[model samples]
Target: MNKAILIGRLTRDIDLKYTQGGMAIGRFTLAINRKMTREKKQEAERNNQPTADFIGCIAFGKTAETLSNYVGKGNQIGIEGHIQTGSYENKEGQRVYTTDVIVDGFTFIDSKNKNGGDSEVQDESYDGFYPTDNDDIPF
Candidate 1:
């Protein structure tokens, strides 16, 4: 049914733009970390490490503007979307294929107060641990 889900941190702030018809569009990259683990059959096979994969996503319409306004670099979010693919010719006449997710929905997953310094102060307004535009905290 062409559905995909991702939970990751934003690599940078969302880039907001408009189409020729004035529809808003936002683009961003997400960095998802995968924990690598090795199982040991003997006494020397236990190995664990962390790796990350970055992905591109796009959002359209009011959702796009909202995401751009509220989200920033390093914010963790959950995305639900579908995969889209396209191809284009470069200056050298080489064909380039691109793939990205067209986001349908998303949610904030990071704690209200990141960096672990002021959990209590941040939690005072942490409804679902997500900060709203109406919140008093400065972004």
Candidate 2:
């Protein structure tokens, strides 16, 4: 029941690392733009308020490896995950609360470039029926 769906751009390149057991872990930040009216946006802009929320995210195993290999800063992606919360004692002897989205799955929302360009994905291996002409239709 605790699920989170987010669509945003990466704030930086994913930091990929491995555990002592050799399991891969990746950490990244996502920048999600806030939804607002024109007037509200203008007001916030004038006040220098942030228009985007930066969220911390983490991935594991194959997901982590895929993210590190294919995605980078400025690339948009859609992620499905759950929110995790914890607290730890830092070097300063202060309790630091942390929240992160543990990614379960993700999809690319951007094409080949960060500037937004149109591209086509040609999957030649598809086996689905594609009628090249009207004569190929059975119905």
Q: Put down candidate 2 lDDT per residue, 1-139, tens digits, no spaces.
A: 9999999999989999999999999999999999999899899999999889999999999999999998888888999999999999999999999999999999988745544543334453554455487788798
Off by over 4 Å in 1: 38-50, 111-139
Kindly give the stretch of ten consecutive residues in candidate 1 with the minimal lDDT sum: 40-49
Candidate with best TM-score: 2
Residue pairs with backbone atoms closer than 3 Å in model 2 (clashes)? none
The predictions' CA RMSDs to the true structure, in order, are 8.4, 4.2
Candidate number of the best lDDT? 2
- TM-score of predicted structure 1: 0.72
How far residue 99's Cα lies from its native spot in candidate 2, in Å, is: 0.6
Candidate 1 per-residue lDDT over residues 4-113, each given as its tens digit: 99999999899999999999999999999765443332223333333667899999999899889777887788999999999999999999999999999998777334
Residue 94, candidate 2: Cα error in Å is 0.4
